[model samples]
Every structure is written in C-alpha cells, then in structure tokens.
Target: MVGRKKRTTICDKELQKEDLISNLHEPLISEILLRLSTKDAVRTSLLSKRWRYLWQTVPGLDLALYDFLNINFSNIDAFFKFVERFFDSHRESWIRKLRLYLGYRHHICGLKSWIDAVTRPKIQHLDVNYYSSDEIPVSIYTCETLVHLRLEWVSLPNTEFVSLPCLKIMHLKRIRFTSDTTLEKLISGSPVLEDLKLFGCSNHNAIQLRSHTLKKIDMDMDHSSGFVIDAPLLQCLKTKIASTKDFQIISSGFPAKLDIDLQWRRRRPLERPPKKVIRDILADIRRVSDLVITSDILKEFFLYSKSRTVRQFRNLSRLHARFAICDIEMLPALLESCTKLESLIMVI
Candidate 1:
C-alpha cells in the first residue's frame, strides 16, 4: 500500500509542474542583445528594474542616427545630448568598444564634444567615420588606447598630426593626403602596427615603409605608378595591377612567400621583359617560397625573361595559373626554372 501511494503522488505532480514553467525566458546570449537598436535598448526598461540598468552597461555603443526617420532636425541635438549623458553617468570603466558613426555630414560639428567624452581611458576600441572640411582633431588621432582605426573618404594634412603609437591595424580607403611624405610619416609612426591597407588614393609615389613589426600588407598599386616596401617583418603581400611594365615592387626583403594577381590590358602588345621592373622587385625578395601567377602574367614574365636560370628559383613550392580566353603556350623552360616547385594548378 505504501509503494502504491508514492506512485500515485508522482503522477499528480506532473500536470501541475508543466503549467508553472510555460513562460518564455529571455535569451542569455549577448549577440542578440547587441543587435537591438538604441531605441530597442531603451524599451527594455519596461521589462523590469534589473533590465533598466543592464542596457546602460552594454559593451557596444552605436550612435548613428537616421535623419530620414526623424521628420524634424530639431530633435538631432537632443539625441546626441542623451548619448553624452549616458557616457557620463555610466560608472564602470570597462566598456570594451564604443563605435560611433554619424552618417550625415551636417552633424559633424557636434561630434567634436561627443568624441572627447566617449574616448575614456577605459575604452579599448574606437571607430569614427565622418566627413569634415576642417582638419582631423589632434586629440582624436593621438589616442593611446586605440588598437584598430579606420578612416574612409577623409582627409588628414601633414603638419597637424604626426603618429599613432598604439595602433595595430589601419584601413585607409579613398583617403587623400596633401603630400607624399605625410602618408609615409604616419605609417612609420605606428611602431607596433601590424596590418595596413590602401585602396584608391592619390600619391602612389615610391612609399618608404620602415615598420619593424608589420606582418601583412595588401595594396592595389596604381598603374603608371611605383611604391616601395621596406618592412623588415613582412610575411604576406598581395599586389594587383593593370600595367605590369609601370608597376615596380621595392622591398627591404621579400615576403616569405609572394602571390601576384595581374590583369593585362588588350591594348598593350606582347613585349620584352621589363628589366627595370623585375630588378626592382628581385632586389627585396631574397627568396620566394611560393609563386602563384595568372596565366596571362606568367606568359608576360616568361616572354620578358627567356631561358633565365631556373636554379635561382629557391624555396618555390608551387606554380599555378588561371587561363581566360588565352591559349597556354608550352613553356617547359618556365617550369624548369622553378627547380623546387612541388605542385602546379591550372584552371581554365
């Protein structure tokens, strides 16, 4: 009778317990919370008192206001004001990143104060994208704690800002500088910098790079222009160009490996090897571990330098090409020169 009574009690509790746990629980993952907009974060206050303060301490703060959504411009100042208020009141100094991108050019003036307020010593990562006729504020450029920075479609003159000591990665897209030395000076200043990217900018004149700690560099060199690489610690390099004759690569030392992508214009005739071009790049690259050449470019390089010593092809592991509406001429000499080639890839 006692055993049967215990079994009967368990059955009765199952139906009662199911109803108690039916409510939906909030998600614990942080990514879902980050996707919510500032407005959505504010709305969370209605959930409970605990959630009210939670949004204030969130790691990421994005303050890019959509002007189209707001009917009146008068409310713009108020939005910026509220954001400034949040940074001031938040006590915790451990904010991981604070990203502020004010899209509209009209509100750039208001950013001066907001930038100064948000760049606390505690903030580790900061990204700002804005357009201004005035110069970049010196205080913004000299941020000691910033590790990654991106300046797009902006201008920074030479005389004002000199260096960024703590920057590790930088992306300058369509950025214009006043002079050639200005860009070089800024690059050399980042002593601990690792990666640098330049896309569609003026003054592609021979750039002298002197980074002791750089690792990767990707540059789309301007045709009819030349640039030099002098980084002692460079490991990977990717360069693409149209006029191979005009492009020159000067390296302090060749990367451990090199991957070249070339696009030949139909108008240029098949001509002799550009001795100046080949010599400039060879001066820096002491050894090329792997060479990936497009089919068209491989033909060009072979045509320019015929029967060159395959013995100098030291440490080369692969020779690959991609053919596009072009016949692959049998160049046994080209393959023979790569004495150490281990594999070849051909994609038609």
Candidate 2:
C-alpha cells in the first residue's frame, strides 16, 4: 500500500510540470504555433483548453494551396472555404507577412476582397503568385508599410498615381504593364527602392530605368527592345538581350560587375552592330571590375575592333569570355584593353 502511494505522488509531480508548461502566456504560445501550417496551426486549438484560442493570434500567415493543382473540383471549393474561415478566425491586429501561391483560376472578386482584407498597415512583406492572367488590384500599391513585394503572372493596375513610401525590394516575373509609362511611374513612386528584378515582362516598348537609390538591376527579356539605365549607385547588372539595337547608359558608379548576353534570332540575322555601338557600351561601363561576354557578343565586338578604336578598361580585373575557336583573333585586342586584368576565363 505504501509503494502504491509513492507511485501516485510521482505521477502528480509530472502532471504539475505539464500544467506549468501548457499555461504559458498567449504571446509565447503563439510563437510556437506560428511555425506550423495555417491548417495545422488552427488544428492546435483542439489539442486542449489552453490552446483553444491561441492559434487565432499568430502574427504571420503562410497559405499554400499546391494541392489545388491536382484536387477535384469539390475539394478545391472546400479548400477555398477553409481559407475564408481561417481568415475570419484570425484576430491578429498586425500581420508581419502574408504569402500566397495559387494556380490559374478566375476568382477575381474573391482575390480582390482577400487582398483588401489582409493588406493592413502592419503588413511588411507581401508575396503573391497567381499563375492566371488576372489584373492585380490597385489596393496593393497603396500598401504604405510594405518593405518587400513579389508578384508573378499578374497584370499591374493601370493607375497613374502610385505611392509605396517604404518599399525597398521589388521582384516582378511574367508581369504585364498597362502602358509604356507604367513601369517608370511605378519606380518613381518607390522613392527608396534598392533592388529591382524584371523577368519575362510584356507590353512595353522600352524601359528607361532612372534611379539614384537603386543598387542592383537584373533583366531577362525575350523581346527585342532597348534599355536606358541611369542608376548612378548601381553595383551589379545582368541582362540578356535578344537584339542589340541600342543600350544607352547615361551615368553609373563603377567598380561594378556586368553580365551581358546578346542573341540574334536565327530567321533574321542582324547585321553587325555598329562600331560606335560597341564603343559606347564598353566606354559607359569601363569602370566595371568583373565582366562576362558571351560568344555572340564577342563576335560583334571583334568586328567592331577592326574599325573603331578600342577603349581601355583600366579598372577591369577579371574577364570571362565564351568564344569559338574562330573568334580567338579578337582575344589579343580584348586583353590589351584590360590593363589591370588578373584573371581570364576562356570557355569554348
């Protein structure tokens, strides 16, 4: 009888330790629950009475409906409903970040409403990927507190007036702009933007990027167009151009890095780019320290060297060239121009 009493006493001590742990305050408990998926987070309420209302206060929401891709119609409908309920149950006054990745669908009104509801003043990061060709709601542009924004496969709103006072990083992929001036106006609105990336964007004749605060610019486009860069503070630049009609550089701070790839369509072979074209491009970025030039571009540069004067790349230290054996004749002239080149890479 005495041994049975001792066992009961030890069991009571273990239960007491568990009670102390489960009784942690809501903020601490919410942190533990926030790492879980939204569905799993919500399901925590069923664990015990102490956790019943704790999941509702999580500060961030990460909802990914990847299963929506393979699920049946009824399941998709149910999944959306579940999302609605989750949002309705969420009671956090300030959400730190919200991410949504969804497949192609025509749920415009629902998406607009959801965006309007979640884009509060406290939201700092917003990422949305909708594989459909729907136009993004203008409400996102008014997110004054957003620090980072990423959007894919969406058309930007056609609003002349845009203001993002705190945005710093913006990435757009497969985005459609309403007009030529749309991109310019959008960049102008973000007074303090630092990094910008554009990939596979459509519906623009030319992109004139003029910014004093931009530090990095990356662009990959399939269309034949030109770029006008005036970012004096830019440190890194990467671009893939389909045609070499014109690439104007007004001004840039150097000791930078440049990666350039130029390709010509097979059906329409472009005439050799003008000697002045190559000279102007090389002269503007002459201060770059690292450079990569593909075989096709080097061929044009080689042809240009035969006619025009080759400018010196005094600050260039590393050069990477992808060239054919026939283009080897240009290497002497190219290497002579780089007075300080320390490393050379020749890829066949």
Candidate 3:
C-alpha cells in the first residue's frame, strides 16, 4: 500500500504540471503554434482538446509541399483541398505572414484563389515561389498592409494604378514586367519603400527608379538596356550589368557602398566603355566608402587611370577587385586613385 501510494503521488504531480501548462493564455499557446509548420501545427490538435482548435487562431502560416510537383493527380487534388480547408478553418481574418512554395504551374486557378483568400488587410509579409509560368495576381499590389513582399518566377500584371502604402522591402527574381514603365510605377506607388532587389527581370528597356525613401538598390540584369537612378536618399547600390551602356546613377544620394560587375565579352572587346565614359562613371560613385569592381570594369579603369583628368576617390576606404592578366600591369595606377583606401582584396 505504501509503494502504491508513492506511485500515485508521482502520477498526480505529473498531471498537475500538465494541467498548469494547458491553462496557459491563449495568445501564448498561439505563439507556440505559430512557430511550427502548418502541417505540424495542425497535427497538435491530436495532443489535447485545448490544442485541437488552437492552430486555427494562429496568425502565421508557412506551408511547403515538397513533393507537390511529383505527386499524382489524386494526391495533388487532395493536397490543394487540404490547403483550401486549412484557410477556411482559420478563425482570424488577419494573418501576420504567409509563405507558400508551390512546385507545379497547372494549378493556376487554385493558386490565384489561395492568394486572394490570404491577402487580407492585416497581412504584413507575403512570400510566394511558383516554379511554373504564371503572372502574379494584380491584387498583391493593393495589399496596403504589406511590409515585405518576395516573388520568384512570376510575371507582374500591367495595372494602371498600384498603391502599397506600407510596403518597405521588395524582392523580385526572374520576374517579367509588362512594360518599361511598370517598374517605375510600382516604385512610385510604394512611398515608404527602403530596399529593392531585381534579379534577372525582363522588360528592362530603360528603367528610371525614383524614390524618396529608398536606401538600397540591387540589380542583376544581364539583358538590360539601361538604368537611371534618381533616389536621393539611397545609401547602398549594387549591380551586375552585361552591357556597357547599361546603368548610370543620376542621383546626388552618394551611396556609401557600391558593387559593380560589368560583363564585357572578349569576342567583342571593342564594346568596352570609352576611357572618358569609365572615368565619368567612377566620378559618380567617388563618394562610395566600399567599392567592388569585377575584372571587366577594372580593365576599363586601368586604361583610364593613366589620364590626368581622372578624379581621386577620396571617400573610398575598401577596394575589392578581380585581377585579370592585363589588370595586374596597371595595379599601381589603380591604387593611386583610391587615396583613402584602407583595405584591398584582390582575386585572381
């Protein structure tokens, strides 16, 4: 009887501990559920009656169907159905963040419906990666509460008006824009935007980016014609342009860091920018503290560094460059231009 009594006492303590934990505030429990993946969070319903409906009120949802592309028709239908049901079951109208990594493109209708359903007024962050060919819904641009948006392998819709009052960070990868003015319009609409990244986006005939609150602009455009920047408050600028006539910084913003990669093909070596043009380009970014130039751009700078008209980069403190065989011969002249350079990184 004594041994049985001790065992019973231990079991009672365990039960009491669990009861205390189960009685935690609903917001605290929702936070715990938010940290879990959608599938795992929903599975918690099986843990206890209290947790059964807790996931329904969680404000964040991260859903990734890894095998979505390889699944059969029946499985795909069932997967989408489950997603639909999950959204339908959510009790809260406002989602803090929603991320979806979809593998297939055939479900455009379903994808559109899902995005429309989740892009509520209170949704702050939305990230969607669709590997298939599909244009992003125009509704995304109107999400007034969106703070951060990232879209991969999507085409931008041609809309007359775009107003994202709260958007600050935007990242576009392999995106297709309808017209040259589409990008300009998009940037103009986001009054408080700070950071923008464009990676391999199409319809880059001549992009004129003008923003009052922008701080950082990063572009990797291989097929771009030209870019004209007019952001007065910009601080960081990075670009990888394939054409010699690709980009020019027209702003007096004076970015602190500049990373430029000019891809000059050897077959058409004469396509390199003229010495005067290279010098003028360097003059624009002379205020940059940290500067990174690829081998192609370094070759142009080396050719022009011998000229007396080349200005010194007084503010440049860090210099990073890839040294080609020709660049090694003009290394001394290049170093002379960066009078305040404190760090040098050379890659062969």
Best by lDDT: 3
lDDT (C-alpha) at residue 29 in model 2: 80
Better of 2 and 3 by lDDT: 3
TM-score sort, best first: 3, 2, 1
RMSD of candidate 2 to true structure, Å: 6.9
- Give, for candidate 1, the lowest lDDT window spanning 10 residues: 21-30
The deviation in Å at residue 231 for candidate 3 is: 0.6
For model 2, what is the error of residue 280's alpha carbon versus the real structure, in angstroms, after optimal superposition?
Answer: 4.1
Expressed as tens digits, the lDDT of each residue in 1-348 for candidate 2 is 999999999999999998886888888888887777666777788878888878778876766676443542255667677667766766546776777777565353467677777675567878888875567778887788888888888778688787888889999888877777778877888989999998888644767888888888888865636778888888888777654534566773552788887655343475655555566666745757888878777666656664332554556798888888877787787777777889999898
Error of 2 at 230 (Å): 2.7
Ranking by lDDT: 3, 2, 1
How does each model score on lDDT?
A: 0.62, 0.74, 0.77
Residue pairs in collision within model 1: 254-284, 254-285, 273-304, 310-337
Residues 1-348, candidate 1: write the lDDT tens digits.
999999989987985674443222343423445566555665676665556556665655665566323732356677667766776765455454665656645555656665565454555566666665655555655667777777665666665565577889977766667778877777777888898877767674666766788888777644325666677788877666555533343555667766666554444556543566554444323376766556555555555555443444545777565766454554466567766778877777
* Model 2, runs deviating above 4 Å: 1-57, 68-74, 105-108, 203-207, 252-255, 265-277, 306-314, 320-337, 342-348
The CA-based lDDT of model 3 is what? 0.77
Residue 33, candidate 3: alpha-carbon lDDT: 83
Q: 1 or 2, which is superior by TM-score?
A: 2
